[model samples]
Target: MHHLGVSLIVFACVFCSAVLGMYLHGRLPDHHLNDESMGVVKLTIGLIATLAALVLGLLISSAKSSFDTVNGEVTRDAANVILLDRILAQYGPQTDDLRVLLKQSVARGVQIISSNDRAQIASLHTLDAYKRGETFQRKLQELTPQNDMQRRLQARAAEMADEIFALRELGLLQATGTTPIPLLVTLVLWLCIIFCAFGLFTFPNATVTIALFLGALSTSIAIYMILEMNTPLDGLVRVSLGPMREALTVLGQ
Candidate 1:
């Protein structure tokens, strides 16, 4: 779902609850429920909070999954490209020029992945570059006979293409799926205010002692961290491309 759509849904939910609660309070004589209803309300809130935590946990897990998938794809794609470069190198003088081109392609790809914007990638002429790889592989067919090693190399090249496409798709999904930080901030702030209002409505015996506050605060902070990670390349929390860097370091090209 789009971040804006989700934000609207969240806002609607909170707004409905607040309006309903206010309506209930207004309809009551002296704004009081049955004398012994405290236990029920507390139990309901506890259950609701528990369920909210469960849903929030699922959301966090989903974000983590997407982040890992994107990172893993990037790493695998980079490694595959490097392996393809080496396989082409095995053609020696016959494919040396093609190998050089592939090497340059891999280098430029590394530079693009390290970038935070798409402009550099566009300037690299990705489509034209991909055609170069295809041409190199086609040339390899005439140079290297169908030996076991050749077969394996060909399979690896194809796999590399798959990984590259998957990584591109994953990157797009990650960029689009991130929850807007502002929406989160608004959601949590309103919830806290609503909780405070609930406490205020319960005047005489109401207590939000330090210990309870601390526990709730801790959980909120954790969810906030998950939101940060969901944002891909933004903020302190992020998905690592350590494996990509490792391959780049290995080539030293």
Candidate 2:
């Protein structure tokens, strides 16, 4: 499901739980809601709340860390692309065709990564990109050098190309959503229970209803942000493509 859809569902579940609690409040006997019972309920809910807070904190940290890791990988890959191009340039005019090919490859990569279509962004056509990288490696290997200097440059260029390919593969692997579904489900369940507790003790009124609504909405938004960050390439939150775009501009020069 889309992240927003999931978040909306979470909101509904949480808010409905509160509404259900209010309904029960009227039906329950007075003794059931007396100070002694209320005290126990508060203590139990407090423990649940603490556990929920810890889990939420962990999820946020993990999602943010994953986002940063992917961003760094992209920046590193862009730098490597530019460095590879410069190495080819230094190898002399014979590498002109190779340099042009590198630019085209980088452009293709940028197009694939920055595509607005979720289907395209999710798939990334990694196989095709890998094939192109292999072809480049073959052509790089075919280069004939006239002196030790040229030979060393050729070897270094090959190594850099390998590193670029490795980085791309690593980035692709990391791009897949790693958030555990069960953990998310458990967190939402905890939120519903907490909100239900909120409604149980309070008298219903416009002000209280508004407060409940805002609380549920805010909780859903937090989950939405976490999900969005988990899939950095295809959501409101995305790794910046500036570095790759800049590398594309420098590729043929």
Candidate 3:
């Protein structure tokens, strides 16, 4: 499901659970509403609440860390690309075609990343890009270096190309969703139980309902943010494309 849809479902489950608890409050036997029963309920809910909060904190931290790592990798890859192009340029006019191919590859990558379409982003990880990269590598290896300087430049360019390819694969793997669905479901379930406990202990009124509504909405938004951060390539909280785009502009110049 889309992040927003998942969030909405969370909100509905939480708020409705609270509403259901309120209904049960009025219908339950008088003994069930005793002080001892209420105390036990609070204690159980407290434990669940603590667990939920811890899980949420861990998820947010993990998502943010993943997002930052990918962003840094992309920036580093862009710099490497520019460096490789310069090396090829220094190798002489014989590398002109190689330089053009390098630019095209970068341009294609920039276009795919900028689109923010999941399908297009997935395409980047597919065999098509891999084949193109292999072809580039094969051509680079076929170059006949006439002197020591040209030979060294060719070797450096090949190394940089391999590094770029590895980084690309790493980024694509990171772009895939990292959050476990079952974990999220369990968290939402805990939240719903907590909210229901809140309603069970309090009388339903406009003020209580509004408070529950806001709480549910806030929780949903938090989940949404976590999901967005996990998908840094195709969502609102995406990694910046400025580095790669700038590199594309510098290519073939």
Q: Give per-model TM-scores.
A: 0.60, 0.96, 0.96
Residue-wise C-alpha lDDT for candidate 1, range 1-253, written one tens digit per residue? 2333444554444444444454555466762565456556666666656655665676688778877766666666667766766665563455566566556656666666467544664454457755765675565555654588766765665565556555655564564466546745554554544554354344322143333344445545555556655756544555566766666565423
Model 2 stretches with alpha carbons more than 4 Å out: 122-126
Q: What is the lDDT of residue 137 in candidate 1?
A: 54
Ten-residue stretch with the least lDDT total in model 3 = 170-179
In terms of lDDT, model 1 sits at 0.56
State the lDDT of candidate 2 residue by residue for 167-245, as single tens digits: 9878877777667999999999999999999999988888989999999999999999999889887788999999999
C-alpha lDDT of candidate 2 relative to the true structure: 0.90
Per-residue error for 163 in candidate 1, Å, reads: 4.1
| Total clashing pairs in model 1 | 0
- The best candidate in terms of lDDT: 3
RMSD in Å for model 2: 1.3
